[model samples]
Target: MGVVSVSLLRSSVFWTVDDLQQAAGRPAFAVLTQNAGPLQLKDGVASRRGFEEDLSALHEFITHLPAEFSTPCMMFTSTLPREGSSTIVAAFAAALARAGSKVLVIDGNLHHPSMHEAFGINARVGLTHVLEQHATLQQAVQTVADLPSLHILSAGPVPPDPFALLLSSDLRGLLQSATDRYDYVLIDSPPAGRFPDAFYLASLSNVVFVIAKYGIVQRQPTARLLRKISTPDLLTSGFIVNGALGVSE
Candidate 1:
């Protein structure tokens, strides 16, 4: 099953109008599309000078992922607080939408979720409410008004025990349901050292995207996290070295 389903490039869902439409801001809408007339990523701005080349690499990377991940890849990303995991996660998601995949980005960092703020989405209801109140994931999810293929699940409100909330029977079920519906699930998790949320996501996600700044990913927590996960199949999806934006002098 893993080998036959792992190729993202071969999936019919990866190339369709429905994928882009779903990503057009419905967090629960998990279709990163390639079959539309022509895909156009809407929400965020792409880096003009280097975006094309950058995403070329990213696209190659995503499509080449292990064949077992083809059914729908589950990748959760996080970092130490202030490591810019949000920036990287959002960028990668936007890129996926541009390429033609139905993408659902759920802000799982309940303690401090910024998905709403980044997209200018009004979070009247978010993950917290969706899980606690048994609300519809579609209702809490908002469409990226201008972006054709981008959806987000905002962190609705702070929960008393965020760990229990994320690992809740219902929320986990929702995540499972999401996999069958979307092409890629890029979850934004809290810093590994600071909370248990990362652990929860690490346990369930097929892959983990670890973001460490130029100098900040020390040996302690990262090693600890790697050890904590402790499974060969459970892998680090990617390592993003961030915070090198510069002024071309």
Candidate 2:
């Protein structure tokens, strides 16, 4: 399993590529450092230059990946919550949409769903509603005002049992339908090691990308989590190192 590491950097954060290489024991796939304070979207489009540059780089990396990595559905998870996987998923989806590829971003993190806020859309009805048969996919799916190619499916109200809902056959059907309609589907899932939700989601996705906080995430635990969740039916794409800097291109 060859792993590619991507470093997401903040302006003030400073760490060397060697630091990450030593920690992950893998070469870097791409280095994306942004001085932009936070992701800012205007009219459902990336407003900040730095953020746009980073997204462009990420999109380039994904496009250049091996032919086997080309898939309609991709899931992004992290070693733990708040590692910035959700932001990456959103940015990547927007990048795809800007390139004229229809993209759907699913907020699979039912426990602490926030993708709705990112896109400035309503989350009152979404994946949960669809899974529970409370709403149809068309009713729950939201389109970005300006970015017509981009769509979002928020987590909706927190379900009583998120794991149970994710495991339902309805979830599979939803993904299948999404893949049929969209050129790409990006799912933002919960932390892998902290919850079983990521594992189950990974099985349903064609490719899984684990996001690890550069300094905070430990190698052994991350490695173990990858091993536990990986299956022959799924492709574990690689690692995305969040919050670090100073890497040669």
Best by TM-score: 2
Q: List, residue by residue over 1-249, the lDDT tens digit for candidate 1.
A: 777775533342212223322322111111111111111233332433454444455456567667777634444443467766675566667777777788888888888788887777887688888788657887877777756677888888788889987776576677777777678887888887788778777777877655544333443445445456535566434444343243111
Q: Show the lowest summed lDDT stretch of 10 residues, model 2.
A: 5-14
**Which residues of candidate 1, in runs, are more than 4 Å off?**
1-48, 71-76, 230-238, 244-249
Go through the candidates in order and give each one's C-alpha lDDT.
0.60, 0.73
Q: What is the lDDT of residue 88 in candidate 1?
A: 58
**TM, every model:** 0.72, 0.81
lDDT of 2 by residue, 62-167 (tens): 6765676454588889787777777777777777888899899999998888788888899899899999999988899999998999999999999988998878
Model 2 segments more than 4 A misplaced: 1-29, 35-40, 43-46, 64-71, 247-249
lDDT of 1 at 63: 74
